[model samples]
Target: MGASGSARPAPFLRIAQLLRDRVTSGMWSVGDQLPSRAALSAEFGVGDNVVRRAQEALIEEGLLEGRAGSGTFVRAPRERRVLRRTVSGTTSPAPAGFTGTWEARSIAKVPAGPETAFRLGIGDDGMCVLTTYEFFTDSRPVLLATSWEPMAVTGGSAVVLPEGGPLAGAGVITRMRHLGIAITRVVEVPRPIRLNRDQAHLLGLATGAQATFIERTHYADGRAVETADWVVPSELWDITYTIAAPPPGT
Candidate 1:
């Protein structure tokens, strides 16, 4: 607590995060002038030195750019990612030389993350079965898939079930057919994301490599049944969605 009876940030880290959030949220736009040092100290209830340290940290993090005569300004936003997602009744089999292809890798039961829960419409007690398989085309390594299946529909049997069940297949349609479930609709959410070390190792690429991220959802009786995140190396894979045209006379 300072003289004004206000609590200050723990040290430089809290201040750094505060500034980062502001910049990320567009509260401080690019080329925008920063508050004066004295004003910042007053607002944060910290000393001038502490404010300076926070400013320096932001500059180092590339969140702010300092001008010789003028004050610091927020950095520009990073480039956006272009993603493509598609859903179809039929899916091609994995290319030659792959052990299990895309869908045969299903194995252990794992907890679903927040996004998975929301997509699958399940609560904390909901369990998800996750599996991953690396794929190749023409003797060159390519896509990596991390698929999730909700336990409610599978009656927890899917979690302990081995990979070589009747569910193994490229398209969810085939799996649904084997499970005796009729798929009513399919949804695909496309996103752009960089490959992490684990994913890179699986895909035979370097960490931080550019990749197209795609999440395709399969629905049964209007309920989101399963979701799969497909990661493809920049040069190895491509996805195209075919949107139907308008009616003949309209």
Candidate 2:
């Protein structure tokens, strides 16, 4: 309840739900043009901004699309591919049946930013090796990644450069193992994000398009060894997780 002592939904959300019901109830079919904001505002006795905000929310959900010089229309649902992954298992670059190719550039002696410093448990003045990656399938970009490792951990070592020398293209566990670091576990946090120009351009998506951003960190006995950020367009993929079962007879 608000200060007025009555519970009420936000104006935009209320309007959005009404519009969604219309579509689902057969009042508006796929490819049908949506009512103008002016019409909706007059019908709801609300301002035009309220109606527009509601429409924009549906557009982000892939339910409504705006055509240039034309009105808004209902959009068909996207056909998505499933990306299944296990929490505690060997990491693969992509899901099965998708043999994608990637281009990566590793730069050494880079300074760690605030977020990287926090993740790697290092000071603000810590130096790092930063690697950027772009993965493609069917000649179209689908994934973007950037990884950071503290230089203090791999400096002057054969495994310093992530994609160079022997054991090149090998994952973090193998490389860290060569350095006598036992990578115990990996942690990942997935969140929603709006793609910037650089990311959207490579993926052929519009600026500010929605995507899944995953921040991953590899740990060795509670010490963070590597951190990376990965992105996948929301319209083209859905992530599925498989949880490991506990031991029997605990």
Candidate 3:
């Protein structure tokens, strides 16, 4: 506070802010290696611990990533897009050259668990068609989802199997619409969870790594039609939803 009688920010915080400004200004491009801790410390007139703390803060903010035996480097931002669900269909658009494909397997006539039955508004003893999906983008597995539909709703229909028939790969809303059940609304609850052993193996993530979990339900004419759980690696995807606001006076 001697120079101008104003207190300076903490050393690490000041450094962190400078680094954030550099990243935001594109001074360091994605995948660009940052200066070493020793070099930064010397340049900034701080100790190595201060530089380390600053770098750690950037890493937590997803601006930098550390590699074993290498160094910290800038991380590429994930692609962000809106998942639009409309009467025509449900579509999630990806960037050019990024094809989002999924592999799915359906198990028919499975007994619904208590939670599943409650979500679907069916008896605990009711049977369901359970389908598991693994989604890939650019040939890399990135997402996993499981959907349960009460057999009473789609047991005898041609779209009984979610990934079968002419409506194959079409989302639940579209398929149910074809069955004369118009899906009017969907509810989603998103939470954070650590990846389990199976999820880690499939998504190529470290066990216990943070991931995004979403529980979604589809409602048709006040009746629940399908419920699903979607798991996505936090580093790979950014999920966004856009809803139109109603006009004034209805």
TM-score of each: 0.55, 0.67, 0.65
Clashes of each: 0, 0, 0
Candidate number of the best lDDT: 2
**Whole-structure CA lDDT of model 2:** 0.81
Off by over 4 Å in 1: 1-86, 89-104, 156-162, 246-250
List all candidate RMSDs to the true structure: 13.4, 7.0, 7.8
lDDT of 1 by residue, 1-250 (tens): 5387677766777877888888788888887888988998899888888777777667545566555446666755332223234344354333222333343465455777788888888875578777776665433346777778786666444323425455435455665555678888777667788778677555544456677787778798778878777786664445556676899999
Q: Rate the local accuracy (lDDT) of all candidates.
A: 0.64, 0.81, 0.78
Q: Lowest lDDT 10-mer window, candidate 3?
A: 87-96
lDDT by residue (tens digit), candidate 3, 117-166: 99999999899999998877656567798999999999989989988887
In candidate 2, how many Å is residue 111 off?
0.3
Best by TM-score: 2
The TM-score that candidate 2 achieves is 0.67
